[model samples]
Target: MIKVETGLADFDIGSETQDVARHGGGAIASFVGLVRDDGNLQSLELEHYPAMTQKALYGIAEIAKADWALHAVTIIHRVGKLAVGENIVLVVTGSDHRKAAIEACSFIMDRLKTVAPFWKKEVRLDGTDQWVEERQSDIDASKQWDE
Candidate 1:
């Protein structure tokens, strides 16, 4: 299963994890990304092209599923105004072995960070808003899977 959501709704990680774990897999790996308080960020507003974002997410999941023996995959990303320490993204992967599940989860996150068409705007405590730039580290992380 592949899911891509962009809204103000907060994801329930435990329920999602349980759903994946019940897919007859021995191991389930998950990752949850949260908005950081760095730079005195007051809130984050995420924008994306709805159709394109969902397509990109599904594409990434497909790649992981093909490369690994994954039984299930779930990805939920929240949009709109998110305060610091709020959940931003959730990724879960289930497989028969821990190695495959772990690698697939990591691969999905790395690819999503770079490949997904989501734009982030950071609102600082001083009431200043700036578009966030993608870090070179994220690009490098995604590139590792190419080899």
Candidate 2:
């Protein structure tokens, strides 16, 4: 099972975990990203082309599933304005063992950081806004999975 969702609504982590557990995998690993209060930022806004974003997210999940033989994969990302400390994204991977479950979740998140089409802007408390640039560290992490 592979599920992908993008919206403004916050996801229920408990429910998502239960759903993945029902798939009868031996282990399930998850990653949750939350908005940070960096640089005196007030809030963050994420913009994306809906259709394209969905396709990209699904593609990332599919690759992880194939490589890990995962029993289940779930990815949820929020768009639009998000307050500091709010949930930004969630990724869950289930497999017959712990290593695949853990590694697949990391791979999905690393790839999403580099491959997802979302545009992020930092809204500062000082009445300034700036577009976020992709970090070199993220690119390197994603490439590690390919090798």
Candidate 3:
């Protein structure tokens, strides 16, 4: 099972992800991406194309399932004005082995950065904001898993 949301609330994906992995008695790994207080921005507002965002996330989940012995996965990304120190994204991967769970989590995050149709607009400290563009590094990260 997978759950995705765009609300501004803290999530508990680890426990849920662990449950899925534990169904068969194995390992689970998760990641929580938080907003940074870097000089580049004072705040971040995320806007996503609803339908496309869900589709892309599911696609990433499929890739993880095919590549690893995963039992369950969950990915949640918040969209809206998010202040620093808030959670931006969460990913959970379950598998029989620690390595599998860990690797799958990394793989999911790397691909999501590029594959997901999530646009981030950063509000600068100087009261200016700009939309972020897809970077080549993001594309390169996803390529590592290509068959």
Candidate 4:
């Protein structure tokens, strides 16, 4: 399952995990990204090119599936305005073993941070806004997966 939208995620992590676990998977790993209240942070706004974003996510999922013996993969990313503690992204990977499930989950997230066609703007508590910059650490993390 893959979804990209501008609405609330409202996902049930346990149910989603069960959905994947039924597919012969012995292990499930998940990641949920939330808007952090970093003192001055108020809210976050996310934007993405409709078709491009979905394609990028699907592409990442496909790569993970190929690299691991994954039975299922789910990625849900939220757009629009999100208050502190709101969900931003979700990644779930299922496999027959813990190592595969965990590695694939991490792989997808690392690639998503650097490769996904999404932009984020931070709205500060002081009524200031700025586009979030990509961190060098993210770039370095993604590089480890390069062939």
Ranking by TM-score: 2, 1, 4, 3
Model 3 regions more than 4 Å off: 17-22
The C-alpha lDDT values of all candidates are 0.92, 0.94, 0.82, 0.86
Ranking by lDDT: 2, 1, 4, 3
lDDT tens per residue, model 4, 105-125: 999999999998889999999
Deviation in Å, model 4, residue 120 alpha carbon:
0.7
- Give me candidate 2's TM-score against the actual structure: 0.98
* Least accurate 10 contiguous residues by lDDT in model 4: 1-10
In candidate 2, what are the lDDT values of residues 37-137, reduced to their tens digit?
A: 77698999999889788999999999999999898999999999999999999999999999999999999999999998998999999889999999999
Instruction: Report the lDDT tens digits of candidate 3 across residue range 1-147.
Output: 555555666677656566566556378788999989886678999888898888899888888877886878888898889988888999988778999889999999998997788889989988998988888887887788785
Alpha-carbon TM-score of each model against the true structure: 0.96, 0.98, 0.88, 0.93
| Best model number under lDDT | 2
lDDT for model 1, please.
0.92
- Flag the better candidate by TM-score, 1 or 3: 1
Misplaced by over 4 Å in model 1 are none
Hey, what RMSD does candidate 2 come out at?
0.8
Query: Which candidate, 3 or 4, would have the higher lDDT against the true structure?
Result: 4
In candidate 2, where is summed lDDT lowest over 10 consecutive residues?
17-26
Let me know the TM-score candidate 4 reaches against the reference structure: 0.93
Candidate 2 colliding pairs: none
Candidate 3 lDDT at 65 equals: 73
